[model samples]
Target chain A: MGKEKRELTGAEIFWECLIREGVEVIFGYPGGYTLPIYDALTKYQDKVRHVLTRHEQGATHMADGFARASGKVGVAMATSGPGATNMITGLATAMMDSSPIVCITGQVPTNVIGTDAFQETDITGATLPVTKHSYLVSDIRDLAHSIREAFYIARTGRPGPVLIDIPKDVQNAKTEFVYPTSPIVLPGYHPPRRATGEQVSRALEMINEAKRPVILAGHGVLISGTANQIRELAEKGNIPVATTLLGIGSIPDQHPLNLGMMGMHGKAQANHAVQNADLLIACGMRFDDRVIGKVSTYSPKSKKIHIDIDAVELNKNIKVDLAINADLAVVLRQIIPGVRVRKHAHWTRKIKEWIKDADRRDILNKKTDVLIGAQVINKIWEGTEGKAVVVSDVGQNQMIEAQYYGHDEPHTHITSGGLGTMGFGLPAAIGTSFAVKDREIWVVVGDGGIQMTISELATAVQENANIKIAIINNGYLGMVRQWQQLFYNARYVETPIYSPDFVKVAEAYRMPGYRVDKIEDIIPTMRKAQAHQGPVLIEFVVEKHDTVYPMVPAGEPLHEMVRRPHVPSDAKEN
Target chain B: MQHTIIALVEDKPGVLNRIVSLFRRRNYNIKSLAVGPCETPGVSRLTIVTDENDSIRQNLVCNNLLKLINVIEVEDVTNVPTVIRENVLIKVQVNAQNREELKNIAKERNARIVDEGERSMILEVTESVGKIQATIDVLRPYGILEIVRSGKIAITRGDDRPEIKNGVAGRGTESSRATEQVNNYLY
Candidate 1:
């Protein structure tokens, strides 16, 4: 207790506050401005561990991945100027996904802040839109509270990333550190944890009256830890459950009533169920344009009920009949008791008919000599038994993973859904490696995305992170190429990209690497990579001209998706 | 439809920038805005008037403003019974012939000539936005040298509103009784 009376430097206070916030690890890189904090880290080495990432962007994504996988606030740190700016894309990705991450950046000395001195930048101003909240700490006394507030705001209601940019002068200044034990009282921030009884009753009434009900589960179900509650409601009411891309594992894929993802590249049956349902219960999801295509005709027959933690998301996209702004699990807990066990045999049969040829349309059944991205993903799924924490990068590979990799557990399928940032998978998988110990972790990235943050392989090797990366090497920016091929008269300009020998790159990082072009080699390469003691990479040479199927063109109705040509029966677009 | 929104925020540096940045980022149109110290020692009040008619977007903007950690409370007073005012200063070029005419115009519009110089006279007026615009329009013929207007500020009427304490109070009621008391004493 006498130690508390002694004054602490701001650098010590920064680490002290983080320790008080229950932070065990930080993903960061050090520079001139952060030298003092790094020195302070030497003092608290045993209490807190720092992972030295190759780049600040990778650090941010690693923090984001940690947050998404473990449901705890992830921490990332960096120096000023370029370092802070590099974290923008990752911060934006976390913002769009509602991941809880605390990003700390060391700023230039207070005297030189606005002089545009060496490595100085107005990061707080630049990151205002991307962060849920941010603090620029100039005073020594405010450092602890600013960090405390940052963690509180970042982890509370509808969690997202928050940043604290600490000037070097503040880090060196001395102050008596008092970690505030009183609960944070921000008069402006009140995250509702429970829905009003009347709203819950109204939702139940709408649920009970509809003959066809489809519950659209989203990432909030995972964040709120309500997958079981969601399944309970769906099963009790005989409702089919559809999910947005980020909502992949809200309901177990093997469950009888679980319809697959519903969005731009969602399954045909999932989209059809949403379009034809009489009551659509959207839980913990914002109605992104990708989810509700052609908003004017989206679920014309459904009396929609939207339940989300963020109030702004309730009516931001599709206007609903009842909007309940509260925690999804709490709201479902309220409504579950009153849910009537109703029979929808005819509606179920209709959905079954819609799903009859889904398996046939899957790329696995195709007798293709050339490897396709979907087939490779399916093979990886078989190799991992679909239990690995799979982080997918954006583009056609992302869609292929979502389609073929069935996640039966919540928080197993993580992707950058809203911002759709490339280069997210590798560092993010590394992040999950630290979060859940002894579990298999995988990063499914495309040839293009993997190259974007490919340098993180060094960080992976340095951390000795047990992560296996599957690069779906299509030799082109496959998604954009698909768009150009279908919409721009097959103009292939600038889409085909050149990649170095990925196996050599992996070898350069001192890890085992494999390249698989033939279909028969896919599983063996996966086994070899999985057997390695540390990080490994497998470059999958897929067909150059394959496309993701069941794609709803931009702004098209969800039900009118383009089906794959090889499907036996439902090849015709509805 | 125009909404008169009042927000109570922490009195700190860059708070206004945060609000303005939020409005700009969200694409919310602000017709006029004003901020000043309130009864609270560490709290400031912001009066924002938006002409956008989409209630859904307005609600979203209000909710977003509320999300700012510095922002304490936000109320859309568009439909509330409130007393609204704007302060305007109009500088007009005056000559021997038009001086008397300008005086008559200012008198009729309930505006006072606060400063009379050799080249021009400045008319000071505190009125509703529509009245202030009308007063400026009438003085325009005398060759308006310059004009500046304080954006609209509004406070809800009646005693049911929150009472002003040492450092915080309900946004709309803090100044209503003070304004009424000053007006009654002046009359």
Candidate 2:
């Protein structure tokens, strides 16, 4: 048969584009408005696997996990109104971490769009800020193009979530489908390329001229696949590398230059090194307030060389002496060759000294009465032998894990960085296990954030994803409380959180669980959790009012760090 | 003297209250606003049109809008022939004496009478700036019992879609085209 010019519905065309885009699976649920798309999926069942989630939120989180693990565009489908709204939190989480995800939602019929009919919602309006981009396809002819654009936007540049809300009438209308062979043509979207020669030269000059230079890496290093290059740069320049919470695995925690995560819950040495540096090379990081702490006082002794793909981030928070707008990978490739192998023995010794001092000041020593968050994370990491995908919810536990866990690979340490999204751990862990079924996935969450989306435990049970959950239950919004302690004159405000019996909640979901009040029970319970065939929840009733020290107060410069109240000298004397 | 203001706000309960509270708190007059979804989910967009000139509006967008977590992106689209519209529903006091006159006025303004009662009339108007204002003026004499107006929602005209590229409409003159191209590639 000759290539027949046959008309197809928008929903069909959208599916056809997905096939061309090499989509292997989609997590979603069917609804009244989205039935047409589900109908199309029936024909493409062999090529695309569709996992029906218990709720739209679960479906989106599953897609996000799939994207992070597979390094491909994750797709989720939902119907209009509440279904679309349900996916909002998941979408925001992916956006903050720059995870690539494509969300397809069905809208009410075009004619009844503004009428607020049954199951009708303005999803395009609802998801605008959280998505990297969104499309409201009003015409059948635009379906193929819109779908193509959605995937393209999702996977390209600083990858993030994109939404395509297709009105029911548009899905039903017929039009000739012609899948674009090339990339979608968008007029406004452009990601920076590798830094130019001049930029590389300036960076190299700054590196050579500085007495003490430090590399502050964020998640961008992994996203850009420049971890090896970063190591090379660090090794050649003999520069110490400090990471943000999301940047945990960008460099191995065991590396000599690695100073661990820097922030409220950062190590004393890492925080001190950042403050004392003469020049700071910040890569693929947005200078989150947690890292810079009191921006005005941060790194007062240093000149910042800010390198990021997004230009708006250059001088956004911490001003820079040299700004390079380029993809981390591309810029790293250029700088690798230009970097000279020079030893900063004096600087290296200073960092080493700080590390030794920090080790002595370990708050979680077996003798301590208080259950230290760091000790729990270290024990869990040791027990898992670095085999599990560690997903952390935002707060003190997240910071502690970032400091303690030895992440050796990309996508292994998953946490919300840019958005600092709470209630992200459980769902993300659920999604991660779905992506890597054979591997162990552990979700490290705080009491406050976990409660926000604890409902996702039901999703885990339904999916039969055997993820291990560790709740660092401190009976408060740990991160907010830390800030209030440091910046708000210890007003405490509403940071205190009262929670239900997490063990009972887990049992209700048919998941085995344990509560560990004593530090001694942590390792045994974690081991028991790991051995379980299905999902398990291990709650650690940590001490309340335990501040994550070495805090860089909000608006304070990075250098002026607040050392832990009990310094190494004080601890040694005791 | 036209200004474009964009706002990024949290997508949560009572967000509108927080936004309304902001306007009330600042006492800055908002002439028109277009709010919708942004590139991410669980976030809302607010595009404000104000009488304040470019510099002052820029300060509001940067300082006021950017400062709010619920408020995300603020841009001034006044020069771009943006498609701005508002939905207004007015319940007017109407009796047999003025019913015909009110109907004639609604017809002239292309407004529809959604519901009617013996003593009250609910008139709905979905229109551009001038027509919406004109319709509101005509109803003032009849005594509007209750009037509800949605903030302006807008999109730039002529296929300059922001969704296709991240920085298309927002970038200033110097690197607008380049920024759009880069955004397209990255997206």
Candidate 3:
């Protein structure tokens, strides 16, 4: 009838809290400051699995990747000072994309928290801007509740990363741990879940009245598990759907109404549809500058309706006519009953017309001498049957992956969207490996980004992650080079970033690594990667001059796109 | 236009630094900020004023402040029907010649001479911002030495208690999904 009597040290309570929270694995690295938890981890090694990452950033990204892939809150751990500092980028990335991840970092002993003792840093102060919430726990009694609160805050109301900075003394202290069976109730926090009837009716009236309407589905749809609801709403209304870069796979990419990725490097029809639509229904997506080129001209004819779970995101950019601050699934499901099914054959045909010259403009058309970035991704797409969880680094390869990968399921494609942080691919894919044990995990990275976090290869090998890494080796930071070639007088200053022998590097990790250059070698190389028993790395030397097409230069209208240059057969550069 | 915002936050170390940094990160300048312990056991209230004209920017700052972990609630109390006050202590240069004049000004303004020196005297007053500004205007006649003033702090007037939804009652010691506990407090 009273509290259960269980005596445990704070470190033991740490692992016990994780087990109670349903955490099956942790991606982390141990250091001096984290000895207590690491020591306690040894006892609970059978209860919870821990994956050692080469770098703290890699660990957080892995956790993020796991969270994205499994639709569960991922956990990362590290020690004090640099360990917590290194997690900044990953935590920021998770914050940007609304990924649910909890990072636990060790602090110096409570006595020296501010004295700058060995390996001590004011992490809570430093990470305030990036994390949804953070707790600096020095008392053993507060340790379990802080962790429980961290998990709760990280996963609810537009999921994000939460940090728990536990001092070594707290971890070593012993307390009567009653593993908080009751939920943590923070007075100030509440996640909005449902839309008002008036807002729904207003949205429906706009939907019914529109002649040319487009639905912009975003990553929120995936987070809220509303892909089916979005599909139903789109299908019932016969509205074409355009996806943001992170919004990819929210709806089946193969669906007829799915207009593919939209924004700067989005497909032609999708961009055109957003520009021309009379009514734009934005579901679970924020209209970032990357998605909407110029707020003044975006969807010029549309009366916009923005539906998002984060109330704070509505009208932050591109003010909408009707804003529904609620869960995407809740809003979509509520409105589906009130929504009337209709046909918009002419509108769909109009959009299809913009997609007319897709064949000649397609990357598949480059079947000549050397390999292109898109071809390599398409090959992997074919080998994996468009079902693999494709994690990509930012830049040219990221764009090409978007252009080529035929995503068929939600949570199948993970990338650094809001932050667009480079060097996220390898570790994130390794994290995804733990999530879908049976499915293929592919890493589409660039030569430049691969070098940024190449040390992650050690983690991949250690975990024996069943992943296939395809490095689009262009011998340069291709995205910057493309931007230079287009905008700044083609001065390739510091753009030609050379990388060391990646095959040799992969060899160091003891995984089979191959360099594929010829266009014909793409498929065979991808197939070989799939056949490898463990993680395999393939460096495909692609054309350095290649660029992502349909470029809507920043600050310009979405309708204004610069097409790729046409090279005649006689005017070959190579 | 100026905006005055009141925020309730958890009483913890480095909270002021966090709030100030958020403003700095957004490149917004704070005119003044005053913080003190509230009636609640572990809660402090912050009253901040910034010289920003745009309501949208003001709302954004409020939203961002609300996102901070320790922040419980934020409200723009400027131009509202509320009880607002600031305290000012001005140590002004004086002699037998100007002391009578300074005393008259202080008495007219309902101020008091809390401290006095041979060459200077301190005028202390707790009043509305408008009254404080008026008093400062009156004190300007005398040579001012050092001035220290508390920033604006406010509470709503009358039966207009804009729900302190994050009351002590919300932090239940019982176990429940954070959301389930939050459901009772949803506005």
Q: Is the docking of candidate 2 incorrect, acceptable, medium or high quality?
A: incorrect
Query: Comparing chain B with the reference, what is the TM-score for each candidate?
Result: 0.84, 0.67, 0.85
The positional error of residue A14 in candidate 3, measured at the CA in angstroms, is: 0.6
DockQ scores of all models, one per candidate: 0.19, 0.05, 0.26
Q: In model 2, which runs have C-alpha deviations exceeding 4 angstroms?
A: A1-7, A483-496, A567-574, B1-187
Global fold similarity of model 3 (TM-score): 0.95
lDDT of 3 by residue, A448-498 (tens): 999888999999999899998999989889999988988998999898987
Cα RMSD to the true fold for all candidates: 6.8, 9.8, 3.9
Which ranges in model 1 have alpha carbons more than 4 Å from their true place? A1-3, A566-574, B97-101, B162-187
Worst 10 residues of 2 chain A by lDDT: A565-574
Question: What are the per-candidate TM-scores when only chain A is compared?
Answer: 0.98, 0.92, 0.97
Candidate order (TM-score):
3, 1, 2
> Model 1, range A1-574, lDDT digits (tens) per residue?
2335458899999898888787888999999899899999988999999999999999999999988888888999999999999999999999999999999999999988899999889999999899999999989888877887788778767889999999999989998777665555666666666666678788888999999899999988888888999999989999999999999999888898999999889998999999999999999899899999999989899999998878778778898898877767678889999999988999999999888867657666676788988889888889898888899999999999998899999999999999999999999988888887867999999999999999899999998999999999989999999999989999998999999999999999999989998888988878888888789999889999998988999999888899985555433442
CA lDDT of each candidate? Answer: 0.87, 0.77, 0.85
lDDT of 1 by residue, B21-135 (tens): 9889878788999999988788899999988789889878887887787887788778778899999898999988788888898899999999999889999999998999888
How is the predicted docking of candidate 3 categorized under the CAPRI scheme?
acceptable
The CAPRI classification for model 1 reads as incorrect
